[model samples]
Target: MRNGLSVDVEDWFQVGAFERTIDRADWPALESRVEANCDAVLQIFADAGVTGTFFTLGWVAERFPALIKRIVAAGHELASHGYDHKRVFTLTAEEFAADLEKSRAILEDLGGVPVRGYRAPSFSIDARTPWAHPILAEQGYAYSSSVAPVVHDHYGWPQSPRTAWRPLSDSDLVEWPVATAHVAGRTLAAGGGGFMRLLPYRFTRWAIARMNEEGHPAILYFHPWEIDPGQPRVADAPLKSKIRHYSGLAAMAGKLKKLLDEFDWTRADALVPAQQERARPWRAAA
Candidate 1:
């Protein structure tokens, strides 16, 4: 099976961990490393002969139109990651809609592709934000990989489906929730991001292999910053946040290279065509 591999394209300072410590207004003043980081990731993908989806922040696209073009030129899919990286549940429907529209338009214009995919900042779509699904469908998004089904302090919809499924019974908008595996009677996050960075490479490999063995394609995601260990640290962040954001950074690039070598990967868009033929309305399992 061809599983999905994605990069959440955002700068180090723009991550949720530093949101409280860093003000948006100060963003322009900070040294921007997104371009360099993105270039590195692109090269890694190029070397591996793989194409993955890039969920880019509109703020980054606006400043680095060339980078967005580079991504498109490399044959990777470009998707939206919201305008300013705000959590979905924190935004009212109106706010979320506007943010989505702005980001989509900007990305489409820059990447020269129909921006059909969205992965909310920090995987923020959950039980409290059911409205987000219909809104995405209404706005022309083909799918979203926004729900991380494991329980976490910042985000996760534990009751949500752990596989790819439509969130609404009547909509074509598919929800490709992040990959997880049942181990020792608990659902552990086996996908990418912090888990991929912090956990031993063997464990993550096992998780993805387990899902693939069951005939389900896993959706793994990571940020460009995750591979850039020398990124500037946010000193004011809480210790837990700091650890979550920075743990195992130095080894992430090597581990990612191993992951790419191990898995058969493709963009999230590639999964939709087959899924659409058999798509069903989502209902919480009783």
Candidate 2:
């Protein structure tokens, strides 16, 4: 099975982990490392002969147009990760719509491709954010890989289906919820992000294999910063945030290379035809 691979293109400081410590107002003055970090990720994919989607932030695109062009030139797909990294649930309907439009426009302009997909920052769309789906559809997004069906302090929609489905029955938008594996009558996140970094590689490999055996293509995601172990750290962050953001940074590159070698990976857009064909009619939890 060809699985989906994605990179959330944002700098270390832009991550939700440091939101409390790093204010948006100070973003302009901060040193930007996303260009170099993302370049490292792009090189790894190129070396492995893999192409994947890049859910790039508008903020990053605007600052690093050359990086956006580089990703596009490499045959990767371009998608929106919102203008800033604000969580969807925190934004009002209007604010979310504007953010989506801004991000999509910026990505399309820089990448020279029709931006058809979106991944909310931190997987922030949950039951409280039903308004997000229609807004996405209205703005012409074909799919969204924004729901993580597990409990977390940052984000999740545990009651949502663990696979791709239509969250809005009245619209054509497909909701590609992040992958999870059923184990011991519970759903364990088998995708990427902190779980992939923190858990044993053996566990992640098994989880993806289990999902694939069950006929679901796993959608895995990581950040550009994951490969930059030596990137500057947020010194004043809380202990928990500090741990989540910085742990396993050095090992990530090796694990990711192993994963790319093991799986037949492709852009998230490549999965669209199959996903649309298999999509079930469903609604998100209220």
Candidate 3:
């Protein structure tokens, strides 16, 4: 079972946790650490002899074209994390389409790779944004890893399937959602940034192992900023947001290493193809 490994490439100041405290216009003044952090991430996978997808921000790609080239050169899939970190639900349909085209064009030109995959910033595509996946398919996105099956306060569509499925009836574009596993009849997020950081590593490993043994590839994701402990902290942010963003920064690298060593991991592009037999039709609305 070759599971999916992904990196949501964005700088520390750009994450949603700091949305209220950090202004997007002030982004240029922030000490940008994404390029160096991404290099570290690439090295981790290189040392482990693994390949995965990098769902890169267009903001990052436009500034660091060389970094985009490095990602492509390293044999990783270069996918979109949107033009900025705007959540799908927040954007009107037209805004969403424009953002999509702008991001795909920038990424493909810089990376020299067809940017076929997308992971919405903050995983914000839910029932509210019923048109999200269909628009992605229309824009030439072969797939999206945007849906997280577990419902949380921020974003989710829990009724969706656990396996890769075509959300639009007419298109082949698949929604390869973040993985989850059932525990006592409840769905728990098997893997992703916050869960991987906040939960005990043993639980994540157990969840992934259980999911894999049950014949599903566990799709795990993280961000470049997650590993940077020295990142500038948002001092005035709410305590919960501060804790969620900063508490586990120092330990994320080691956990990623363990995942690489213990589990069979592959790029989403490679993993999605094999999931077709398991793919079913998923409704955009409940």
Candidate 4:
């Protein structure tokens, strides 16, 4: 069973964890480690003989076009992570549309692909963002890995289908909610990011292994900064944000290599073609 592997490419300073502490106007002054961090990620995947997708920020690509080209050169799918890291929930529908189109244009120009996929910053597309899907379809995105199906203070729509599903009856744009694990009868976030980084590796391994045993494919994701333990710290950020963002940076690389070696992996586009027929519309939450 082949599963989807994804990298959310953004600089360390741009994360939602630091959103309150770091001002957007000050972003240009912060030194970027994304290019080097992403290269290390590419090397890790190469060593494991794995290929996957990258949900990249247009802000990063404009500054590191070479890195964007490198991702495409190494057989990874190139998709949007918005122009800046703004969550879809924060933006008005028109603002979201502009951000989406701008990011797709930048990535398509640099990566030389159709830019058919999008993963919102912070997994921000859920019950509240009903307008996001139509704009995504109109903008020509084929899929979005932007919804999480577990409860969380930041984001999740637990009632939404745990598998890929169409958001609209009329459009082909499918939503691949992040994979979850049923633990003690409660659904938990198991599709990487903070969960993969902060939890014991045994848990993620068992979760994915179980999903595979059930004839299901899991979509696992992590950011480039997760493996760069030496990344600059956000000193004044809250204890919770600091812990979530910085706690397990060192072990992330080893975890990913083991994950790729253990699972059959492919780019998200490859998985979606096989899944389109199986995907059913998820009714928007009232």
State TM-scores per candidate.
0.97, 0.98, 0.97, 0.98
The residue ranges of model 3 lying beyond 4 angstroms of the native Cα positions read 284-286
Instruction: Record all residue pairs in model 3 with backbone atoms less than 3 Å apart, i.e. clashing.
Output: none
Q: Candidate 4 on 1-286: residue-level lDDT in tens? A: 9999999999999999889999999999998999999999999989888899999999999999999999999999999999999999999999999999899899999999889999999999987888999999998889999988889988888888778898889888899876788878788888888888889998998888887787678999999999999999888999999998998889999898888988899899999986777898878646
After aligning candidate 2 to the native by TM-score, how far in Å is the CA of 179 from where it should be?
A: 2.1
Model 3 TM-score (2 dp): 0.97
Model 3 agreement with the true structure over 105-188: per-residue lDDT tens digits: 999999888988999998898889988887998887888988888878778888878778888778778888877879887788
The Cα local distance difference test for each model comes to 0.90, 0.90, 0.89, 0.90
**Least accurate stretch of 10 residues (summed lDDT) in model 1?**
277-286
Model 4 earns a TM-score of: 0.98
Model 4 spans with C-alpha error above 4 angstroms: none
The segments of candidate 1 whose C-alpha lies over 4 angstroms from its true place after superposition are 284-286
TM-score of 1: 0.97
Q: Residue-pair clashes per candidate, as listed?
A: 1, 0, 0, 0
Positional deviation of residue 231's Cα in model 1 after best superposition, in angstroms: 1.0
